[model samples]
Every structure is written in C-alpha cells, then in structure tokens.
Target chain A: MSIFETIRFALRGLVANKLRSGLTVLGILIGVGAVILLVAVGNGSAKVIEESIESLGTNTLTISSGGFGRQSSTSTSSTSLTVELATALADQSAAPHVKTVSPVVTSSSLAATYEDTDVTVGSFIGTHPDYATASNFSIKSGAMFTTDDVNDHSKVVVLGSTVAEGLFGTVDPLGQQINVSGKLFTVIGVLAEKGSSGLSDPNDLAIAPLSAVQESLTGYGSLSQILVQAVSADDIDTAQAEVTSILNEKLGVTSTSSSTPYRIMNQAELLETRTSNAKTFTTLLGAVAAISLLVGGIGITNIMMVTVTERTREIGIRKALGAPKRTVLNQFLVEATVLSVIGGLLGVAGAVIGSQFTIMGTKPVIVPSSVLLALGVSVGIGLFFGSYPASRAASLRPIEALRYE
Target chain B: MSAHRANRPVLDVRNAKKIYGSGEATVVALAGVSLTVHRGEYVAIMGSSGSGKSTLMNILGCLDIPTTGRYLLDGVDVSKLNDRQLALVRNRRIGFVFQSFNLIPRTTALANVELPMAYAGVRSAERKRRAHAALDLVGLADRADHEPNQLSGGQQQRVAVARALVTAPALVLADEPTGNLDTQSTADVLAVLDSLNQSGRTIVLITHEDDVAMHAKRVIRLVDGKIVSDQRNGHLAASRSAMLRDAYSTAVYR
Candidate 1:
C-alpha cells in the first residue's frame, strides 16, 4: 500500500479507540513536559547565581584571616590580619594594581531601634567608604561616610534597604538617629535595594565607619576581613600577588612555609565554581526527567501491543486482501509515532507556557537543546517501543489470524 | 465457454496434498486431490465438516501452501512463490469472499472494495472510481458510504462480492458466502453472484449446502480429503448457453 494510505489507516485505527489513544498520548505528554520544565528550572537557578556573583565586582578579592585545614590551626596565633596590614597594602608605590582596600569588622546580630520600632540587623558591618564601591552597593539617598569621617571617629551609619524599611517604614530617615546596642548613630545614607541571592540577603545589613564601630561595639580587635578591589578585571591576579607579598613581609612569614594566617578568595574563581556546580545540578534534573520519558515510552509499547491484539482479525482481512507484511508493520508503527509526536508537540507548548511564571523563586529559563532533545527522544521512543507489537502483527499467519475470534 | 476452456485453464492443480502435524498426530486435509477450472466457469466444491473442502479452498485461494503439489493460477506457478510473491499473486490473480463477509470493520463499503486494488498500488482516483463501479454492479451503489456494521447481512455479503469482483482476478473464491444470511438475503447474494458469472467472471463457491452447489454449472464433492464426484450439470449449462445466445442476438440487432 502507498505510505499515504497506510498513514490514513493508522490514524483511523487510533480514532476508533479514542479514550485509549488519548491516555497513551497523555502519558508521553507528562514525560516530555517534565523534562523541559525541570531542566529550565535548573538553568534558571544557575543564571540567578551567576548574576549575583557578577554583582559583587568581578575584580574584587576577599582577604580573610583563616586558611584551609592544618594551615589555619598553626598560623592562627602567629599572625593576625590587622588594620595596619590593610593600610600598608593600600600604599600606591608598593601595590599599583590595588585600587581600594576596605577593612571590615562585622557584628553578627545587633538590635537596632528607631523610636518604638526595634529590629535585629542580620549583619552590622564597620568598613571604609570604599566597601560600598567594591561590593557594588549604591547609596539611595545621602552620601557614603568619607575617609575624614573614619579618621574623626564619627558616629554615623548607613542602613541597607531592608534595615531601613524595617526600622522606619515609609518615613524618611536620611538624617534620623537610630540606636545600635544603646549607642546612638545618625543614618547618613540608605543603600539601594538588592534582592536576596540564594545564600543570604544582601539588603539586611548596616554599614558604619570602622573606627566608630570598633570603639563602641567591638573594642580594638583584629579586623574581621579585608575587601580589595583591583584597578580592572585583568589586574585581579597581580593585585592578589601584591597583597600576599606585603602581608608576608609585615607579618614575618616566609613564602616557603606553605602555611599562612590569611586566605584571598578570587571572585572570578568563585563564579566559575558556582556555574559548574549549577551545570551538574541541571544534569541531575535532566536525568530524573528522562526516567519519566522512558516510562512514557513503555506506555506506548503497552498500548500498541493491545491495539495489535485487538485488531488481529482486521489484520487478517488486510492480509487476505493481499497486503504485504511490510504494509501491516508500517501501519502500526505510524500509528504509534503519530501518538507520541502529538504528545511531544503539546509538551513543548506546555513547557513554554509553564516557564512564563516564576517557579520556586526563580524564573525558569528554557534550554533550547532540552526542548529539541525531548522531542527527538519522544519520536525515537515511538519507533523503538512500537517495533515489537508491529512486528508481532506482521508475522501473524493469515489463516490463523482469520480463524481467531 | 468452450473457446475460453481451449485458451487456458484459469486454475490447475496436480495432486495437491496438505498434511497437519507430524508422525502419530498426522491428519491429511487434502489427499492427492487434483482439479482444474477454466475461465467463465462457475464451480462449487461441496463437503460436510472435515471433508477437506475448506483445505482445498484455502490452497486454491493462495491462503495456504500445499505440502506437496504444483498449483498454477493464470499460468503462474504459485506453488514455488515466496510469502511476498504469494501475496502479490493473491492480489492480482484471485479474490476471496469468506463466510463472515470479512469486510474490514469501521471502513466504508467503497473502501472495502478498493482494498485489493490499493494493495495492487492503484492510484486513489482510479481506485475510488473502480470501487464505486463494483458497488453499483452489486446493487449497493447507494450504500457505498456505509460501514460494514451499518449494512444488513445480505448487503454486507453483496459488498464482499463487490470487493471480490473489483480486482477482476482469474478466480473469485466464495467460501459459504450465504452461510450467515437469511433465506431472502441468501437469494439476493446468490443473484448478484449469478449476474457476475453471466458476465463471464470465473467463480469457485465452497459450501456444504446442496441447494447452493446446484447454482453452479459444475459441482465437485469431497469425502475424507478425496474427491468422490466431479460432474457438470448439463441442463444448467444448456440453459446458460441459450441465455448467452439471446444476449448475443439482442446485441446484434441493436
């Protein structure tokens, strides 16, 4: 028989059993839809992480006073990263690649009150004004506390967007005073809103001059960490090397010792690590979705087998009319393929529509390749799963089939 | 009819034998039975249950291969043909009408008739035109769009007859074509077959009914896988020739 006639026959056969055929299609639809949607969610989360990391200036490096494993234990007492070390690293003659160095001391949780409202700040940080530039924090109103304010030990603080909203609500607090652990400080600026990255909320902290915070809340202790910005993205490596050498000389540590009391984390390296981690997560999601697709393929096999058995007499009639075995096989195979292809197309539409809304706090980004792969696999599933039943129908002896009840 | 017999036998079988099972459980369905049928002939093979008439019918219809035999249809040695080639032979050279009508369910009467032609790779337009013509010949032209289930038993049988004749094969094998029909429906189906035979289409009707067998010009009775009698009804042949002469004279006068 002609291919056109065979396809028509197959379609008519499916139409004759509408409920069964529709259920089979629905199985495949769920499989394909899950694959595309879940993978898109994985991709979306990865994009969110990458953007957040990029927001923390790609040329910036965080210098903290701890090393990994054994190195951290032995070197903890030998040399502590202090404000003096931060100052020396900032010298123009010694470190040309280093653009700005901000020494930061953090008080983890401190209750701050404005009038009757009191809220516990997630992070109360003491740092130079340069911390604002390095961390990409922009002032919404009023200006950042200047270097002169740090030298004078001014009792001034900048509220992050979340902190400001909690303490003052709609009321403007540009010049209002807020109490931090019983110490009153004027709010000179409010940081612009930054949405929470997966790790922590960046807009739930307050910033102040290092000298004022150390004198009041923390006393003269080792600086919490150092924030260093390289002059440009390409200068990050050279700047890190310069800072290492300066710290090594001042702290009396030899380069050959293999242990240091400090560690510098490169923002670019962190981004690469996070992106790869996200890719692994996406792959895991894809694998899970693929299992459902396999089950859907199995569903096709089950339905096709039933159809072949039910139509044995019809097959015999066709054979008696002189239809070759190949024609019979093609008819059943085409029927199965049509079912899956329709389901796959609907799945693509479903995934595309489902991705439009945010899912689990992340807007899903559809991967083009996942859509194509799901469709291709569904078609392949139809052909692969369809073969067994079709061949069974084809191999049936005409006399026996005709004799069948 | 004599001129057609002189040209070539439409079907020729030499000692066709069919066996079932092996050794201890062996049973012979067709035992060294030989038969020949010519163009423009209507032959009926009659037998009770287990008389091997069905076996011989199957072999003659190309639906089964004999254990040992040389069978030719339209001068083609079908005994040596493979499954694929046998299917082609069945499509081009033989038409079958089963007892149950065997029309594909859910298909229109027209498409049922067009089936054999479709397997022969005929184009859609030509298939449709020929299918409609065949249905018209069976007096089912108005019911061409009806499915098999929608047609009555007699109409369904007539549709099967239309499907059988649409291919214009060397032989039309009808296996108990009226077995499922009422008396009136049987008459209607048999009348369609008579008209087809009158138009010079070869027919082989397999039935146990003596009345049905009497409709054919030649009757072969099988007993226990062996043919006991092969005779021609002289009276029927003589009357059919008279009818043909009247048709010829009318054509000449017109």
Candidate 2:
C-alpha cells in the first residue's frame, strides 16, 4: 500500500477509538512536562548564582580561610589575618597585576545617625584608601579617603548609595558630620547606584578608615580579613597564587590537621564551581523526568497490547488475506509513533508555559535545551515499546485467530 | 489419492494431515485426506459440523499450512513454501469469499473489490481500474458506491464475488458464499458465481447443503476429516449451463 494510505488507515483506527488515544497521549504529555519543569527550576537557581559572581567587584580576588570553612573560629582558634600583612602585600612592585589592596576590620555592632532616624546597619568595614579603588566603588560625590586619612585617624566615611539614601533622603549629605557610635565622622563621599554586587548587599554598609575604626569604638588593634584587586580580570589566576602564598605566611600558620590557616575564593574558582554545580543539578532532575517518560512509553505498550487482543478477528482477516508479518508490525508501530509525536509536541508547549509561570521576574533565566532532547527520547520510547506488541500481533496464527469467538 | 502427472490437475493433494494440539492429546482435524481440482473447473466440498470441511478449505486457501503431506498448487509443492511465500501465492493466485459476505463493513463495493489488489502492491490507479472491471463483471457496477450494510443480501454477495474476482487470481475460494441469503438472493449469488466459472475461472466452494452443492460440476463429501464420496455432477452442470445461457440471452434481449 502507499505510505499515505498506511498513515490514513492508522489515523482512522485511532479516530475510531478517540478516548483510548487521548489517554495514551496524556501519559506521554505528563512525562515530558515533568522533565522540562524539574530541569528548568534546578538550572535556574544555578544561573542566579553565576550572575552574582559575574557582577561582583571586577578584577577582585576574594580570600578567606580554606578547608577549615565557616565556624572554624569566633576569636583566636585559627590563623589570624592582620592589617600589617595586608600592608606588606600592597607594597609589592614586582607583581605587575597587583593593584590597590585593603585589610578589613569588620564587625556587626556599628551605629550611625544623620538627622535622627539612624537604623543600626548589620555590616561595617574598616579599610585603607585602596579599599575604595579595589572594591569597584564609584564615588557619586566627594573624594575617597586618602592613605593619610588612615594614618592620621581622620574620622572620614563613604556611604553606599542605599545607606546614604536611608539616612539622608534626597538631601545632599556630603560635607556633613555623621555620628558613628557617639563619635562625629565626616561623610566625604557617597557611592553611585550599583545595586547588589555578589554576596554584598548594596544597602546596609558604612565604610570607615582602618586606624580610626580600630582606635575609637572597636578598641581592638586586630584586622578581621583582607581584600585584594588585580589590574585586570585576566590576571586573577596569577594574583590568586601570589596572594595565597603571602596570606599563609603572614597569618603565622603551618598547614596542620585541624586547620589550613585561611581560605580563598577567587573570581575564576567561583564561576567554575557554579557551572559545575548547575550541571549536576540539571542532570539529576532531568533523569527523574526521563523516568516518567519511560513510564509513558510503557503506557503505550499496555494500550497496544490490549488493542491486539481486542482486534483478534481483524488480525485474522488481514493475515488470511496475505498480509505479511512485517505489514502487521508496521501498522501498530505507526499508531504508537503517532501518539508519541503528538504527546511530545504537547509537552514542549506545557514546558514553555511552565517557565513563564514559575520564574517570576528573575533575570538570566534558564534556557531549556533538554526539552527538545526529551522529545526525541519519546520517539525512541514509541519504537521501544511498540515493537513488542507489534511482534506479538504478527506472531498470531491466522487459523487460531480466526477460530476465536 | 488419484495420480496427477504433467498437464494434470491444477491442485493435487495426497494424504494431507492437519492435527490440532500435540502428542497424546492431539485431535486430528484432517486425517489422510486427498483431493484434486483442475483448471476451469467448479468443485464443491460438502460436510456437516466437525467433518473437517472448513479445515480443508483453510488449507486449500493457504491460510493454514498442512501438518504432513505433499500438496502441490499448479505443480509447486506448497508444503515446502514458507509463510511469506505462501502469502505471496495467496495474493497472486487465489481470492476468497465467505458465507458471512465478508466485505469489510462500511466499505463501498468498489473499495471491497480494490482491497485484494491493494495487498498485492498494485498501483492505486490500476487497482481502482481493475476493481471497477470486477464490479462490472458481477453486475454491481451501478452499486459501486453502496456499502455492504446498505446493499441487499444478493448485492452484498455479488460484492464479495467481485472482491474475489478483482485480482484475476487462478482460483476463487468461496466458503458457503450463499449460506446466509434467501432463495432469491441465493439464486442471484449462484448466477454470478456460475457466470464467473463460465469465463474460464476455477472455483472451489464449501457447503453443507446438497441444494447448494448442486450448482457445482463436481462434489466431494467429507466425513470426519476423510473423503467419503467424490463424484462428477456429469450432465447436470452441462444442462444447467445451457439453461443459464438461454435465460441471460432472453434478459439481455428484453
């Protein structure tokens, strides 16, 4: 028979029993839809992390205590990072990509007031002149604190755009005095609006000179940590290797069992880890969804087998009329493949709608490539499941089938 | 079994055997049966229920392979031909009609005739043309668009006959083709089959009614899978043939 007639015959058979065909297709749709939705959500979260890493301070290398991880120390257990070490690293001329660096003396309890409404911000950083340059902060108003500001204990501060707005709305608060825990400090500069960058919240920060923050309210001479910036993004690898060696030596640490002294997270490592984590998550969810698709194929197999039994006389009639086994096999296979193709297309449509429904307003949204791959997998499912029942139908003896009541 | 040599019978079978089930529990459906059908001959095989007449029909139709025996179809050993080859032979050399007027339900008369050729892989245009010619031969040309359920019993049988004739096969196998029709319908279907046979087509019919078998030129009575009597109708079909020719000529003249 002509190819068109074969399809026409198969389509007629499906149309003859509409509800059965719909139910079969329904199984496939849910399988494909689940795969698409599960994979999209997992990959989307990973993309958010990547976006945070990319928009962080440009050319900056972040170093923290490694191996020991978080909760290694509240005070004096692990290797202590000092401002003197940060100063030593900054004074290097041999490292060409080495740029301005800063040592941070961060603490939680820092108070500030402009008019009267002063909310205690959670974060505070005490650093040098290079702190502003290395952190990618663009001053919106007055100048950054000079190296002399740290040396002379000048109580000067620069507020992030959000913190500036919260304390002194629309009013130009530059050249004004802000009380920091009962001590007056001049707001020399206000940062321009560059929203949240990586782990740092744009709001809730108050920058102060390293010497004044240590001597006045804090009353401690120790540094919490240090920050470094490279001249360019490409120099991150070279800069990270040099900075690691310096911090390990400076922190007074010998690599021991309980601690590796300090930790480090550079721009390159951050991006690399995020991508690998996303791949793992996407694969895990995709596999779960694929199982559902396989279940759908089994559903088709179940239905085709029933159809064979129900149409026993029809098979008898065709066989007696000289229909070869291959012909009978093709007929059933066509029916299954047609059902799967329809289901797969419907699944793609459902996934697209789901992406819009779930993602809300997050940027750098996940792009689903597996939805298409899943559809192709469904076609293979049809061939896989359809084969057994078709072979069974073909194997039927014409005389015995005809004799069936 | 009778001897069949070169330039001999079109179909020859010797000691054919067909057993249902296996070993100690087997029931023999056809036991050492033998028969022959020549080209351009009309033969009727008759038997009651459990007499294995239907089983013989199935084997002759190539729908079932015989368990043991040498059955030669036009001098080729059918016992040796595989399932696929037997299917090819059935498509090219044999056509079938059933007592139930086994035209596919809801199909038009033309499509019913076209169905056999379709399986034979004939091109669509040729299949359509040949089906139309077969319908014309059965006097169902004007009822070409009539579905089996829409037509009268006689017309439906004529359509079945048309289906059997469309492929121009060497043999037309009718298993009690007129069993379900009334006397008038039976006469109509018999007249159609008679005309086909007169046109040099070989036909084998299976029926339990002696009245039905009277239309054939030869009769083989089967009992319990064994042939009890095999005889020629002798001068009965010759007289009937002349009578049918006169009747058709008068109808055409009118």
Candidate 3:
C-alpha cells in the first residue's frame, strides 16, 4: 500500500476512537508544556539574578569584616574597617587600579517620621558621595550630597524611591525635613526606582553623608564596610589584590592566615557563582520535566497496545485481504506519531502563551534549545514507544487473530 | 466431466496432512487428504464439528500451511512460500468470506470492497470503479456509503461477497457464509453465489448444512479428517443451467 493510504488508514483508526485518542494527546500535551514552561521559569529566574548582579557593576568589589573564619580576640580591633583604611586604599600610587572608595555604615530598622507620616527604614546607610557611583544609584530629583557636605558634617539624606513613597506619598520631599532617630535631616535627593531583586529590595533604604551619620547615630565606630570601584572590568582582580594586600599590611594580618578577619568579594566572581547556580537549577527543572515527558511516552505505548488488542480482528481481516506486515506496522506507528506530534505542537503554543505573563515574580524566558529538544523528544517518544505494539499487531497470525473474539 | 478435466486445475493438493501437537494430547486436523478443483467449479466442503473441514478450508485459503505434502493454488507452490509471499498469494489469488461477515467496522461498504484491490496495489480510481461494479453485482450499489453496522445481516453478507469478488481472484472461499443468517437472508446470499458461479467464477463453500451444500455443483463430505464422499449434484446443475439459459433467452428477446 502507498504511504498516503497507510496514513489515511491510521487517521481513520484514530477518529474511530476519538475520546481515547484525545486523552492520549492530552497526556503528551501536559508533559511537553511542563518541560517548556518549567525550564523557561528556571531560565527566567537566572536571568533576573544575572541582571541584578550586572546592575551592581562588574568592576566593583566589596570589602567587609567578618570573614568565614574564627574571630580572634587580639585581631578584633585591628580587623575593623575604618575610614583611615579607606583613605589608604584610595591613594592612587598605593593602589593604582582602585578608582574610588566609599566607606559605609548601616543602622538597621531606624524609625523616621515626616509630619503625620511615620515609617521604619530597612537600612539607614551612611556613606561618601562616591557611594552613588560605586553602587550604581542615580538620583532622580535634586542632587547627591557633595564632598563638601561630608566635610562640613551636614545633616542631609537621600531617600530611596520606596522609602520616599512611603514617607511622603505624593509630596515633594527633596527639600523637606524628615526626622531620623530624633535627628532632623533635610532630604537632598530621591534615588530613581529600581525593581527589587529576588533576595532583597534595593529601593527601600536611605543614604546620608558619612560624617554627619557617624556623629549622630553611629558615634564614630569602625565603618560597616568599604565599597571600592576598579578602573575597568579587567582590573577587578588586580584591584582586589591591591586592596587585600594593603588591608593585610595595615591590619597586621598574614595573607596566608586561615583566621583572617576580613573578606574581599569580587562582583565578577559573585556573578559567575550565581550564573552557574542558575544553570544547575535550570538543568534540575529540565530533568523533572523530562520525567513527565517519559511518562507521556509510556502513555502512548499503553494506548497503542490497547488499540492493537482491540483491533485484532480488523488486523486479521486486513491480513486476509493481502496486507503485508509492514503495512500494518506502519499504520499503527503513524497513528502514534501523529498523536504525539499534535500534542507537542499544541504544547509549544501553550508554553509561548504562558510565558507572556509573570510567574512567581519572575518573567519566564523561553529557551529555544529547550523548545526544540522538547519537540524532538516528543516525536522520538512516539516512534520508540509505538514500535512494540505495532510489531505485536504485525506478528499476529491471520488464523489466530480471526479466531480471536 | 471431460470439459471440466480440460480446464486448468486452480487447486492441486497432493496428500496434504496437518498435525496439531508434537507428542501427547496430539490432534490430527487433516489426515492425508488429496483433492483437485478445476477452474470455474463450485465446490462445497461439508462435515460435522471436529470433522477437519475447517482445517482443510484454512489450508485451502492459504491461511495455514500443511504440516506435510504439497498444495498449489493458481500454479504456485504456496507450501514453500514465506509469510510475505504467502500474503501476496492470498491477496492476488484467493478471496475469503467468513461466516461472521468480517467487514472492518466504521468503514464504508465501498472501502471494504476495495480492500483486496488496494492490497494488490491497484490505483484509487480503478479500485473505486471495480468496487462499485462488484457492489452492483451483489445488488448493494445504493448501500455503498453505509457502514457495516448500518446494513442488515443479509446486506452485510452480500457486501462481503462483493469484496470477495472485486479482486477477480482465482478462487473464492466461503467459510460457513450463511451460518449466521436467517433462512430468507441465506437464500439471498446463496442466490448471489449461484449467479456468480453461473458467470464463470470459481467458488469453494465450507458448510455443515446439507441444504446450503445442495446449492453447490459438487459436494465433498469429510469424516474424522478423511473424505468419505465426493459427488456432483446432477439435478441442481441441470436446474442452474436451465435458469441461466432462460435468463439469456429473455435478455436476447428484450
């Protein structure tokens, strides 16, 4: 028989049992859809993390106290990061790759009030003007506090977008005074809105001049952390090395000591770690979805077996009519393949449409390779699972099959 | 008898034997049976249950191979043919009509009739034309679009007969063709077979009913896997020839 005629026969067989065929298709549909949708969600979350990390600037490095080591009583005082160390790191001749250094001190859960509005700030940060450049924070209205304001110990603060909206609503707080821990400070600027990263909200904090904040709220303790920017992306490693060696010398700590009290984190290294972690997550999700696809393939095998058994007499009739074994095998194999192919195409459509909306605060980003792999696997499943049942039908003897009830 | 001998033998069976099991609990379905049927002959094989008639019918239809001995159909030694070649032989040389009218469910009568021709690799247009003509011969021309379930038992059997003849095979084997039909429907099916035989088509009917076997020109009775009698129905043959002559004369007069 011709290929076209075989395909027609297969289609007729499928149509004869529409409900069973539809259910089989639905099984494959869910599997393919799950594969594409889950993988897309995984990839999307990874992309979100990468973008947030990239926004922090690849050329920047953060030097913070409290490393992954046992703290020693003798080194506690020397391990504290201070403005003196920050100044030393800022010296061009000592660390030529270090473009800027901003010393930061944070006071968590600070109560601030403005007239009738009262809100608790997540982080009240005290840093120099270069903190804006180091942290990639751009001012939306008004200007950042200048170096002169830090030198003069001005009581000025910049509100993050979320904090500003919470304290002032629609009021312009650029020049208005807000009370922070019983100290009145003028709002010099409002930072532009930045969407929250999955781990934390970046837009719910406030920044102030380091000297005034230290004098009022912190009382001149050691700086919380130091933000350092490299001259270029390629200089981040060199800049980190320079900072590490200088801090070691200034604090009288050995470079090879296992109990070092300070840690230098490169943004690039953090980015690599995060991206690899996301890759692992995507693979995990794909594996889970692959299991469902395999189940769907088994569903095909189950349905085909049932169909072969149910149509045994019809197969006998065809055999008696001179149909070759290959023809019967092809007919059934084609039927299974058509079922899975239809389900796969519909699943791709479902994934595309589902990806258009945000899922769990992450916009799904469909990976083209995942889509192609899913479709290819679905088709392969049809043929692989379909072969056994089709062969069983083909191998049936004409007399025995006709004798079957 | 001389004229029948002059015709080429369509079926040549030389001491065909069929054994069921190897050792204990063995059953012999056919025991050293040898028979020859010529072209354009209407032969009926009759036997009670377990008389080996069904086994011989299966062998003759090419649905089963003989355990020992040679059987040839249309001059081909089907005993030695492989499964694929046997399937081809069955498709191009033999037509089968089962007692149950095994039409593929949910398929139109026309497609059912075209099945054999399709397996023979006939083109779609030619298959359709020949299928329609065969259905017309069985008086089911207007029921071509009906499914098997939609047709009555008699009509369904007639459709099976059409399917059996559409391929113009060397021999038509009917296994209890009227066993499932009522008396009236049996008469209708037998009439169609008689007309087909009159038009020079070879037919082999397997039945246990003496009344059904009476319609055939020759009857072979089997008992315990052995043929007990083989005789010509001389009176039926004469009446059938007279009927054919009367119809021919009427056609000429018209």
Candidate closest to the true structure, highest lDDT: 3
My TM-score estimates for the predictions, one after another, are: 0.91, 0.83, 0.89
Q: What ranking of all candidate models by TM-score puts the best one first?
A: 1, 3, 2
On residues B1-254, what C-alpha lDDT tens digit does candidate 1 reach at each position? 34443357778998999999999999999899999887667899999999999989888988888999889887788988988998888888788899999999888999899989989999999999999998999999999999999999999999999999888777899999999999999999999988877777778999999988888989999999999999997476664574455344324422
Per-residue C-alpha lDDT of model 2 across residues B31-130, encoded as one tens digit per residue: 9998877766789999999999898998898887789987887677888888788877877777888887766665678877887677778888988888
Clashing pairs in 1: none
lDDT of 3: 0.91
Find the 10 residues in a row with the least total lDDT in model 1 chain A: A70-79
Candidate 3, superposed: residue stretches over 4 Å from native = A66-73, A76-78, A82-99, A219-221, A231-235, A242-261, A275-288, A357-361, B1-7, B234-254
* DockQ ranking, high to low: 3, 1, 2
Going through the candidates in the order shown, the clash numbers are 0, 5, 0
User: What's the true lDDT of residue A18 in model 1?
Assistant: 94
- Report iRMS values in order: 0.9, 1.7, 0.6
For model 3, how big is the CA root-mean-square deviation? 4.6
Residues A321-398 of candidate 3 have per-residue lDDT tens digits of 899899989999999999999989988999999999999778999999999999999999999999999999999999
